[model samples]
Target: MNEELLKMLNAINSKKEEAKKLVMEDKIEEAKTAKDELIKLQNKFDIAKDLFDQQEKSKDEEIKNKVKKLTVEDEEKKGHNAFVNVFTAGVLKKAVNEEDVKIYNQMTEADPTEGVSDGGLTVPQDIRTQVKELRRSLDALEPFINVEPVTTLSGSRVIEVNADQVPFDNVDEAAQFPDVDTPKFKNISYKVVKKGGILKVTRELLQDSAENILSYLTNWIGKKARVTRNFLILNELDSSFGGDKTKTLNNFDSFKDIFNVVLDPSIAISSSVLTNQDGFNWLDKQKDSDGKYILQPNPVNATQKLLFGRYPVAVVSNKVLKSAVEGAPEAPTGYKYPFYMGDLKEAITIFDRESLSIEFSNEAGDLWGKDLTGAKVRERLDIKTIDTEAVVKGEVSVTV
Candidate 1:
């Protein structure tokens, strides 16, 4: 636009210079003609300038409107309205005025699926965020299990697994085989169990302090489920398949024996380790020839705690992997720290039938009379040992 305007100005200056030259030559008629041409050029330039100015003004107005729309003040106003709609209008059923109540009632009527009277509001996104943030209080045990979602609550799933191949001598191609060997498989049955807790809260707290109450209860229930399931898995491994591929370590030097057992060619070596903090601290002190710690960060994935840079290690709480007296049958005196190392997912499989679900009700049997609301959260999951040989469990004496 500026270039076009410059061209017009240059044309006008050229016409004026021509007019002056004509006047100096005493050609009055030609000079007057040049002046008229200059006037016409000036008029065109003025029209173009006016159009450019109008275009610039419109562009400035558009930019100002966009900036106003995107301002933090506008966003804050929207947030305030959202908060009011969720908390006051929806949950508490309150209205700032008659106009807001009408709007809120209309919104409620439009979406019949919201609120406890309906199927229960999808547990507000903000409340869910609070739940997740609080869930970090529990120990991180998600990596130990390969979770799968299933629609059926109870059913049997067929799993085809490769067994250790039998050894055979070389035979001629034309010779008939003695016997055929095929891979073995077993049926894995899954059943969902209802695991949850009911929390009673006063009406005042529900209306005024929903966030804090939800966070606390969700954390409590989550911890219970996680800790309970983790221990069940560890206990089942010890009770049901303890004697399979066992390795009892008497000294720190023999720690490699457990690793070798897991990494043995006969079984899958892609594994993780689970032990109490005491066991982890013991392994943490083990040094190489260069006097460096053996428990180094995993090279493949930096987030994992690798043992000898080979296997990921998860520190189960002492409550689950408890210290017990384990020696020879004749003399069971020394304190033994239990450790599990192997293909964790293959060894102990967790079958989840449903995700964690929560519901709130103000009208329960006793809660209604007591004027309290009940928040209940539950999940469906069960654990079973899939392949005993895939994992190896051992105990190390703390005295050693």
Candidate 2:
């Protein structure tokens, strides 16, 4: 636009200079003709230029109006889902990165599902990086999860999710509980994930249930404990068994079946053997009952205790259970599996008849280590390394 305007201005200025020269030479008739021609050309140019300027100004005004319309200030009163897409994207990156690292690092002996590891990090890193790039396009958006405002369009006001095709039920209370930016996604819905600031999973958190689970997991499991998980949907089951893998007393399924049977009945469990020591006196350490050992007799009061007297119960599907119980036990009613007596201490599961099951085998696929037990999750946004004393003793640092 400026270039074209300059061209026109220069044309008029040059013609004016020529006309002045024609007058200075005292060539009156020639000067009049030259002046008249210049005036006519200038008038012709103005006619076309007026329309062009009008169009240009109109375009400028239109763009300015659009800029005003999209202002964050304008959207503030509207519950505009300014950040939904970008937020969801960020959420997605965090979830996938965590999942990939977690599932990949799981006990390889148990999974036997090996893939090539990339510098100790999996190839999923590539996918997360790509998603983050797409997320960058949303930088202009204000980070938001908008709630629909009540409007006179109907009556009073209405609260609705503004995102199209995304689950816009309500503000994910989980999105900001236990302090903002705290880990809350897994507790909110173990299956549901955040992506592009959108709900990208099949589940939603039941506020009360999620809160309780989060609390329990936080209390039992240390906040710093690294939990690894792999979500598997049991679409079909091979519920048949007869040979070496069958549920006879000495077989693998038999042991798993027994443990499953005992654990399924309750959410919690207790082992009197661990919690109650008749001859040994753990209580004796607190005989004076001061400082760290401040309580005597029952250190665990009616409400609080750091120790889990027994192994915690876990949830598994009925199909897995039925498959485990495919073969019947041949033992007498009073008889028990040798594992129940804690016989295999070094490399086998120790299954006690009363209340505890010790998972000891390196190859044993125990569900206990497979999940976060519904703890809230937050990504560190940076790589971390295992720096235990063993590494120090070896004069090495195991980094990831």
Candidate 3:
């Protein structure tokens, strides 16, 4: 548009020059015609300039609207941050601004289902998501087992096929059907239980920034929650296995038999080996007759180790999965470590209530006298073994 206007203005200027030349040359009629053409060109230029100005104005308005939308989004983010700061101050039982008290109350009183009146405050959604991600880093057993989210405090899941059964018999056409054996079912019941602990914070730590305070709290809660769940699942796995089913890995051949002979072919296809750090260390040192290491790098995941070039091996901390020494005095001592191999997802199920609640107290125990604050975090969940045959509990012992 601007270019068009520039061209029109240049044409008008030329016509004016032509008109002036004609008048100087005494061409009166030609000069009048040139003057009329110059006036018409000026009018067209004026119209085009107005339209260009309107277009520029429209573009400016569009830019302003976008800026205003971005400002609103930034303000919303600032508001949420302010709320989190106020809530964090309240949790630490520190002094909060009077104007921001409403924000704190909104967080506490917004959800009656969370039992806020009883002093329990639900962790903010964003913080919860962060904590969950952190918890996964510390988890060992939870990721492998089947997790079922449940709303009820207590419930039961019925298993129609507990074990492999015989297939139906063939029948002739138009012949009477033969009677079949009644199917058996096993009911696995679970009741959610509370697992929680108190984390004490020094007065100095409470005075830190809200982000730092939340980070400390989340790290503590995530680790504790993961450890509690891992302990419960491991306990259930131990209880499900019978003495007859549990075996000792005396040599490399014995370890291979766990997948080839002990576990069912169907279960072995999807099985993984689980052991503590101590057991893994022993297995990592094993060698074949050709002097090659038995533990190979997993083809699918290079970070993980595979046994028999097939099953993935999962290693947990020795502190979590402890080792036991068995044998009489003066005899060769056996450092027995757990070597559980099987399809863990099909073996156990965790009924998760999916609720984590936190409460704060300044007067709990010696916190008040010490000028410290205590935050109590609680988690609810239940674990049960669905199939005992899905896993083989083997003890890998290092004898000396």
Candidate 4:
């Protein structure tokens, strides 16, 4: 839009210059004609300029309008600033090892626990934020999942399907008409799942070292959650939802052939491809008759790779989409590399009930005998396949 406006403005300036040149050359009649055309162009330019100005806004101003305002209380509750005192202000007196005590202070300063009375610590907000950011960056399946932060732990999403009533080929000019199709709705529920692990840290390490233990712990837990969530998403995508076997692509074919089977023509152009490393490797090696690579760089995001110059590609781990093995006749050959393609935004939904939560216990049975403190991190989330038909799955094996 901005580029178009700039071109229009340049044209207007050029016309004005031509009109001025005509007047300077003493061509009175020609100048009048030029000025007349200039006036008309100016009118159109004025309308376009007004529209352009209205549409263009400072990026900072736009960001400010979209982002929620932070209050003083919220600011105060943010990072190390909030937890520094809670963990360092004579909180852990029982841990006698000075080295362990130093490590604990460093951890607390990084991510302070809310209540230190029961030897349990509430992870700081900044640590949680950092962990989530890291997880999003590292998680391969994150790009393809539709994430929604919901207040409730469990809720239902309604998927609407319109009846496939054929359009009338011919009808009387004044004849009565009926409804084209009835809409059908399918209700799918999302139920949160809880996952957490307890880890023991020695008192010496907690008190002695200057390492950012909180960041390390939060990152570990965040990655663990991402792995678990990706596995669940893969399972949901592979499930026999609605028994729509037509959406499956079990054999190798041309891009158009496979894409047509997996996605509707109307929504096929801007889609996504999710598969294992083997699947992407095969796609990356594909070429046209001229030997040009079939896959292209995504225009929307320069950092991303696109399939056939259209769909973005995400390569999941073999655990989610099994890798292929060649030269073994006895081994499984069919669907070894599961490939899923479609508008995942319309198919898969992830509901986050709560952000990540971290809790610590000094007296946990698992760590009590070992003189270590236990930390557990958990999050509440769920995945749902909103539209089974919108997503297509297939298997392809290609050697590169």
| Cα-based lDDT for every prediction | 0.66, 0.29, 0.79, 0.64
Question: Tens-digit lDDT track for model 2 on 95-162?
Answer: 22333333433412222222222111121232233322342232111011111222121222122222
Local accuracy of candidate 3 as per-residue lDDT tens digits, 1-400: 6778889999999999999999999999999999999999999999889999999999999999999999987754544455445546656555555444454445434443333334456665556666677777853578888999999999999897734584577899999999877778888999999989988868676567756767787788888878888888878888887366678778888877888898889999999998899889998998999999999998789999999999999999888888776787557477788888999999999898877777778887898898776778887888988987899888876777
Q: 217, model 4: CA deviation in Å? A: 2.9
Best by lDDT: 3
Please write out the lDDT profile of model 4 over residues 1-400, one tens digit for every residue. 5777678778878888988998899988998998888888788878987876766656656766656455443443433433433333323434323443344445445333334544445554556677667667654576676888898878887766633434544566897775555567788888888877765666654564233645556667777767777777767876733234523333335456757654676557657787777777777887878999888887778877987667788876666567546656575444345667778877788888656554566665757787776666678888887766677666555443
Clashes, model 3: 0
State candidate 1's TM-score: 0.60
- Per-residue CA lDDT of model 1 for 1-400, tens digit only, reads 6999999999999999999999999999999999999999999999999999999999999999999877955644443344343433323334334443344334334343334343233333333444544543546454575656677788777776664464465778899867756657889898877776766656565455434544455566656666666666767778755755557877655667666644555443577778887788777787878898888987777766787666788886776577676576567656777787777777677676645545656677898798776766666777777776677778777653
- Clash pairs detected, candidate 2: 83-144, 87-197, 88-195, 88-196, 88-197, 89-196, 89-197, 150-157, 150-158, 340-351
Error at 376, model 1, angstroms = 2.6
Winner on TM-score between 1 and 2 is: 1
| Candidate 3 local distance difference test against the native | 0.79
10 residues in a row with least lDDT, candidate 1: 116-125
Descending-TM-score candidate ranking: 3, 4, 1, 2
The per-residue C-alpha lDDT of model 1 at residue 205 equals 56
How does each model score on TM-score?
0.60, 0.22, 0.73, 0.63
- The positional error of residue 231 in candidate 4, measured at the CA in angstroms, is 1.8
